[model samples]
Target: MSVKRHAFVTEENSISCSQTEQTTVQKTETGSKFTCQQCGRSFAAKGNLKVHMRVHTGERPYSCAQCGTSFTRKGSLNAHMRTHPGESPYICKLCEKSFSRKESLKAHMRRHAGVKPFTCVQCGNNFTRKESLKYHMRIHTREKRFKCRQCGTSFSDKNHLKDHVMTHAGETPFMCDHCGKTCSNKANLEIHRRIHTGEKPFTCPQCGKSFTAKGNLQTHIRIHTGEKPYTCARCEKSFTYQRDLKRHDSDPFNCALCNKNFLLPTHLRIHLRRHAYARPYFCSLCGKSFRWLGSLKWHQKVCICAKTLLPEF
Candidate 1:
């Protein structure tokens, strides 16, 4: 049998003998082909070696016009352009759901077909995708690939690392349109927007009461479950939330304006309001103002005082 050989493509996409000479190819007993010069990964053909070289070289020739995201292959760039227009060419016949890429449709089809090909040898757990299995295997091996540039904290996944870095930087990318509030993540902002939209997605199974956030739903479920995650160190009393636990602590945080101490920082903030001269809330009836809403409501009911009142909040 004649041994099949092909010329390797250069960085410029031209087949060059000099580029092929850079890499060494050794055939194994099973007829393995080309090996990587850097990583020692074996490839069947010289063309595949040329494509795989981009991984080590960080060479991305293909780019999308919409987002300007570069890709190693031209096919990846073409698929990325479909995402800009929200165009899904591949449609599943089972549910008539659309996907931008064929691979996504295939993954979706696996969910309906109940097919899990990727399996972990150690745990014997099955996953729908290979990447899911790879992530799961990190638990057994304790492999952390992603590292923070700022804090030097390592994470197994990129998403967790991104979340950790946000705490260090105090970066709030997601913003609310109504209240001008900002959040570190999109999910938190989405939950905050529910306060305005009144859209409750998380529902309690026991009481049928709905909440804007899943955390709130989980906390509600804890009422039925009787699960108290937070506890006081001194009293050994349990609470549902951290705020409730802090509330039980007597006089921890102190007011900067006054010498009086409070359990919570929020109580200190309310105490500091009494020292401020600015009474922002104006009464239309008396043309007078007050600092606290409770004082204003009290003034509206009983007091016909002509002067502005800065009551002790």
Candidate 2:
């Protein structure tokens, strides 16, 4: 029995040794000896496996000196460093636009070539960039990963969440040069600047009417199509704009100062002017200012100057 046990142990050791030798030979041939223990992924170089391990380990050794932004790979760190000094090495030949990274230049070239390589499987929509497609997918998935802590408002996009958070803090970083008006984002500031510049870049094809914003142009196009997307749940009334639907559903506007309620926004605006002591309507004869047109007319009727001027006319 002891002799049989010894022979079995020897055979098992020999088999293990043969398998190890075969694996080493295969690694020598293929040049992929370095394998990740965590993920079981094979790499040709030892340095590559070490770098790949950082993903699982959550290690970011390469960090930017200027911004202190850490990256897993040295190549990514080098690419990010260019953004600090505004050093754009990659240049577009057609538009003469410079990009910090080669990948950005390639994406810009796709616009010139009219090439959309990345496509959505669900919607069949094509995008120039993979990141844009990923963001678009969140719409179909109804995934609201980014949520505002203050308002409990959820946004699918991270940048949208960032912009929404600024509203809670009352942080307006973007300032309009023309009006000195502050906006939450640069896009809003640009649109506000268009009021001064009269730059209507978005034009309707059917009506030939131009709008300052692309969203306004899209809404204008709906007028030709007769498409009312915003529908009231209670009244079943459809509206071209979402704001109209909101107004239809909303209660009478209440004044915060006087506790007065108004049905129309115009009436609310006039009422607010009274509270603010803003007498915009002026009497032509007396040179007196009144908050409302009715008040101005009543003042002109009793004015001595108006009575004398009326007899002269």
Candidate 3:
């Protein structure tokens, strides 16, 4: 029995060694035979080599079941499946909002905690995800790898590439049943439906202001924190809202004081507020009043004569 066991062990070792040598030899031969003609690159398997050929030939065999989106690989098809499924399995523990993938769920959680883990190596600008970091890095690299086939618009991300493709196909998969309005994407359709449903789930933590869109909620939060992201190119004056900066920069309403144009009518009205002699900003020193705060401040600074003025404006 001991002799038989020794013989079996020796045979198993010999077979394993032979198999390893065969694998190595086969890999070298396979690499040499089925290498890419365009890029001069080798793939491990013949199927992978065929798929790599699609890069040169611009072939997309695998198509989407829902919208007939042609893709190079099965993995892309699987990812695209989530769009139709609307089955967000990955749920954020912080907000309890479900996302299709783990990465998306992680990004969604970042908004709740205000975390930007990924930072740009060149500019030190922060992003919530590595994909966004990659997109930002492209700005430093000046690399636009993805290009649109229809209009030649370039993007840093793959999703943007796919979205551009939809423009050529004229495919709007997401449709509203209530109003019969079509949207290019499901996310857009959802936001459009909010107009009819009157649903504003995103609430500001600082203020009780609600927003139908998450992007709007994000912008509104900046108001409470006084974080102005948009800036004027001419004067370099920053504003909490893009519209505010645009109005300030473009001057649509034609300010009567500065003789400048403004974008919004309300901004021009506010500028008019400074000129109106309504005593909006009152002086506490001599119980005096002025139309503008600057005038009241100036009076308070050099108030020697008016010791006792009218109590009310």
Candidate 4:
């Protein structure tokens, strides 16, 4: 009897080799053919082939004892059990990061410097994980499937809803070992520790400005890149930063020359420099002048532009 083999396409598009040998059954004087109803694929044994049929049908009959993750076959269940033991045979060549699954190691290697190969077809946004792509789909659908148990706040993603629920519960699970300070998220706690440790991990490539958080560093990059995402509602003036937008929106005083309004007195004073002329104090030497007497005195002492004759203080 010839031994039959099976194959399965994994998440990475690689074919998984068959683990078990196929058993053929005899019917009457000849051989009996058994077919899997789900995938329309034929098999030898009803039991051994039943597991193989689950692979094509995307069915997970066997479940994990720890995490309750279901698998198509017992071999897959055995392979998943290694995840609970934290034993990863796959290692990335770029970053030297170990992953429980070979597919995970491939994804982790992309984050070494910066690489986003998988892009969304709908929005053209790139993401490292396929799960991220799934979550991003909800943004287009405007689907709020996950709801917070506390305040009934609905979010499209479960993680976002979980974050929202934390605010209502006031649950600060991440506590600093150095200090008693607590934070709702572990990443936020890690960023907040920089205040005590004086650590700035995120630095701008354009300017030498440093920030504790990557988001702040991204915003700082826009200052040099001149990428304005914020805009004013009243005047429709765009600004690179939110603080600039707020200042532009809240300005009370308007410039007489350009007719532009500014939030601070210093900003208005700087704008006045472009239009201002007629230096009142005149030089006794060349008739050169300045707007302020202090400027005239400095010019007169230097003997460069003009000398303003001062009477008495």
TM-score: which candidate is best? 3
TM-score of each: 0.37, 0.42, 0.46, 0.42
Collision count of model 2: 0
Q: Tens digits of per-residue lDDT for model 3 on 178-270? A: 999987667788999999999999998777888899989977877676766555556655667767766676664666566666678976776
Q: Per-residue alpha-carbon lDDT of model 2 for 1-313, expressed as tens digits?
A: 2322322231111222343342111122344265554445556765676676665555779999998867768997898788764678888999988889799999999989999999977647677999978876774455799876556789988878767756655566668877789986667889999999999999998989999999799779878977665655554556678677667667366677865557888888988987788999998887889887898888987888887777653
Please write out the lDDT profile of model 4 over residues 1-313, one tens digit for every residue. Answer: 2234232211222233345444332212124445444333344554666565444444668899898867657886887777664567787786666667878876787677578877877546577888767775664455788865446678886756655545554555668888889875667889989999999988887778889999799777766767665645555566677676667678967786676888789878766865886467776776776777787777777974333444445
lDDT for each of the candidates? 0.70, 0.72, 0.66, 0.65
Kindly report which residue stretches of model 1 are placed more than 4 angstroms away from their true locations once superposed.
1-81, 84-86, 166-171, 178-181, 184-188, 191-313
Query: Which has the greatest lDDT?
Result: 2
In TM-score terms, candidate 4 sits at 0.42
Give the per-residue Cα lDDT of candidate 4 at 270.
64
**Model 1 lDDT per residue over 126-158, tens place:** 778888888867755557899865567799988
- Quote the lDDT for 301 in model 3: 70
The segments of candidate 4 whose C-alpha lies over 4 angstroms from its true place after superposition are: 1-90, 100-161, 233-236, 250-313
Worst 10 residues of 3 by lDDT: 6-15
Model 4: colliding residue pairs? 279-290
Which order, best to worst by lDDT? 2, 1, 3, 4
Q: What lDDT score goes with residue 217 in model 1?
A: 90
